[model samples]
Target: MKQGTKGFVGADETGAGQGATGRARVPAQPGAEDVGRQRNRTRGGGTDAVPGRTGVDGVRGERTHSEPALPRPLPRRPVQRSSVRGQILAALRTALVTGELRPGAVYSAPVLAERFGVSATPVREAMQQLTLEGAVEVVPNRGFRVVERGDRELAELAEVRALIEIPVVLRLARTVPAERWAELRPLAEATIRASSSGCRATYAESDRAFHRAVLALAGNEQLVRIAEDLHRRAQWPLVGSTPGARDGGARLVADAHEHTALLDALIAGDPDAVRSLMEAHFTGAV
Candidate 1:
């Protein structure tokens, strides 16, 4: 888990915005403000509740001693563990990428548990992980809040992906084995099909897998891992359902055609044409 609290995943952009790019907004927990408001009310009531104030009943009107002695609400304690905590963390990570957890918003274990229909134990574990990742911040008395991302970071990530993958495509254009394309072409088609109608989660995975298949043909596991990391980090903003598009997923069919065209060039060992097409594909819409 990377710690910074200001970063989140990508969403499916073709479903909204200028093109196939969108942002995920983390959703805030419900009724988080109620607790503080309730406590404030008790402090605001009457002067008799104060130490030296005299009441209308005179003669040191009987105070409910227990009221004054009641313990104040304590800060939520951190949780420890890996399994259940990991599950919560996984859910939260998905939520962050899928736009369920909006940025700049905060949550507490109890609130998250209630929303998730689980115990605070897992939620706490998840939040701690998030704290370490810098996706969320833990306030002293208050609970966790989410971090916000800037435009520069987003654009740079896209640029970086283009820088790495475009070159690889150019290199592989004329060199990739015919057997590799035989294997990858169907996967690309499947990805296009999945993206058109499947759930965002499933579609996102397939979409990434298709790209990975192409990159893997280059035989650089290290580069593949780096790209995967970037993809994982962008999940929230790149995979979820957007508010204004029904045909967005359909556009992937066109992307599949682009893949096919690249494969055709590769089969013919046309490196220059491959480079030109691959760069245009990556930099054009994505």
Candidate 2:
């Protein structure tokens, strides 16, 4: 993150008020105060995971879903060997993204273990993973605190996504087989289902799946993995939000349509349209 805004080196205009001589005077240098303010105005501000369930802080000051509570229990995972950690990770991510695990709230692994009905081992393991993702911070003796996220972090995540996916997606669109593109339509549409149902957990998975599926078409595992990591971070839940003209979840619904449009553009092999769509989708609207 940027630490501070750079100081202005010159004047705003070439006039120091209309000169008495009918000629504009050379502008004065920026005042010390102005220079200092500009230099420090910009400052640094403060994770990826999966979803387990729905909307949090839908309408703050009314009823904050996260206040005084842990997130709802983890979603059920399909039985598989060594799946406990994955399930816990998914659940924890969902809780964070949905405001279930309120930002800045510290939660012990043992407590989280109880919430998910699991042993502390997996819970702690899962938290360590999150720490690597910058989603949580370890307290000396307390536990993990869900790192607070806001619009700035969201924008940075989007920027990262834009940087990584734009060129790759454009290339993939031009070269991937039409049949392969056809196979991805359902995955893209999964966002619509999650949006319509207003299920945050489901939406999180579907959203991640859509992006991953699309990027995977490029046949680059490393690229796809990096993109997925950014995608997860971009979806991290905000600590608070400014009341807007639209509801909080409006962007998610709109994104479903955006993904569909993008898929169509990709299938058509219109690199221009694909580029435009990808740029717009990362506007942090959701």
Candidate 3:
């Protein structure tokens, strides 16, 4: 498993599907080398090469001016094939969360691969993973389309999360030591910084990190896993809003500050304050 800046979310050390860290463990694909060789052959003007277009350094060039431009600029960091699929998956998630990939828009693998400066195979694999996550869906013979989640769905997700997490957090506050709660202050502060930076993706990870760290103190791995999944689903960008929009940024900073307040309540061993703060936190999450 590759370590991301915010850390991988779900995969365990053995590459099993679930873990405390939340990073995914991707399986290796066979014939990746064959795919690379085929791409090279196409670039070299082999049978796969199209007429009137030349492949330059593995990217097809000389567009006929008929292709539509991407709706927004994608992160263009070039990546290598060694563990490339997971890397691309992470990048695509960041894009999705940050609104670089707009909802209801279609994006083909080749174009995204070109943007990432990698082969299409890894990009396709990454898209497939996104499909499983409900972040995007496959559009037959075209590309993957970002899923548009509505306010109702977001509200329902928040409700489910509250039902699951609020009680557990309140329970932990009564028993956990003040020092244990103190340890999480940095993560709470990190969320504030991420929100202030105006990067939704960064704030999303930090937000998750703070919550996961809090939940992990309960020593219930299964509970942590379940809560994390619900939390992630809730974090998806809502429809009809630009990524990091002004209101959204303000909401994020407000939410980020709640983490610290929640921590303070926990440290004070005040379950009443914890309950109140947690309720407000989830309510405002929508």
Candidate 4:
């Protein structure tokens, strides 16, 4: 979000030059051309003036030519503390999902803050939020340690998501108009693009966006929030798994394609197709 000034200042052409401070120097007097000539001669040490000594005008070794000053660096806008905390929280979540922050590894807030180029306060705040989400636990005097999740826990999270989302999506497919479902096609397409990039973080966000859009049709704010939270938790990589492991990109692309298929089923007013696709999607997610 930092904006910087571009381009350098150019030298003036009408005998006016920029001073060392980047301000424009005063132009020579109109009728005093003779005086200007004499000053130039004195500067060149062609007259009685010494080259490096102070002149009669108290000026010392003034240059005869002007050099363009280097552009000053622009000041960066200060980031808000809340914004910093939110960003750190998001980054930590992505790291958890991608397995960059290995499970059971203790991470100090000060160390993380230094890596993020921010103060420890925001990182600690973000860590506290992650702790609340059960993503990490405090190690007292050490730091926060990532909580390892096994296959069973991941499967259970997926199962909970299926239980919450499948019925709601199926009900909406029957009552919601085709046009309403059609409007979500862009969000569904976004998942495919994100998956194709092979970035788990991008895919995770787009996947949640698509599901949240679909569930929003249910007209239940609480359900959407709860379902999204469960969806996020289910995205964390299994313990000891590396990023993009287990045919990651291929699996993501396959799951992303299912989104468009589910959208098609909803638009076609086929509740059976919607239910089957939803169940399969949840199953494949784990």
Please name the candidate that would achieve the greatest lDDT relative to the true structure.
Answer: 4
Count of clashing pairs, candidate 2: 3
TM-score of each: 0.56, 0.68, 0.70, 0.71
What lDDT tens digits, residue by residue, belong to model 2 across residues 1-286? 1488756343335444656686655667778776555433321110111132222212223222233555589678786535999989988888876778878889999988998898988899889999999899999789999898877888888888888888888888778877888888898788898887776667878998988887777778998888888888776777774322226668778988898898888778788898888899887436
- Against the correct fold, how does model 1 do in TM-score? 0.56
After TM-score superposition, the amount by which residue 228's alpha carbon in candidate 2 deviates from its true location, in angstroms, is 0.7
The 10-residue segment of model 1 with minimum total lDDT is: 238-247
lDDT of 4 by residue, 120-209 (tens): 999999999999888999999899999988889988998999899988887887799999999999999999999999888899999999
Alpha-carbon runs more than 4 Å astray in model 2: 1-81, 242-248
Error at 29, model 4, angstroms: 92
Q: Per the 3 Å backbone cut-off, how many clashing residue pairs does candidate 1 have?
A: 34
Q: Rank by lDDT, descending?
A: 4, 3, 2, 1
lDDT of 4 at 174: 74
Model 4: CA > 4 A from native: 1-79
Question: Given candidate 3, what's the lDDT at residue 56?
Answer: 37
Q: TM-score-based ranking, best first?
A: 4, 3, 2, 1
Per-residue lDDT of 262 in model 1: 75
Q: How far off is residue 64 in model 1, in Å?
A: 61
Clashes of each: 34, 3, 8, 0
Task: Give the poorly placed runs of model 1, Cα more than 4 Å off.
Answer: 1-90, 124-144, 238-257, 284-286
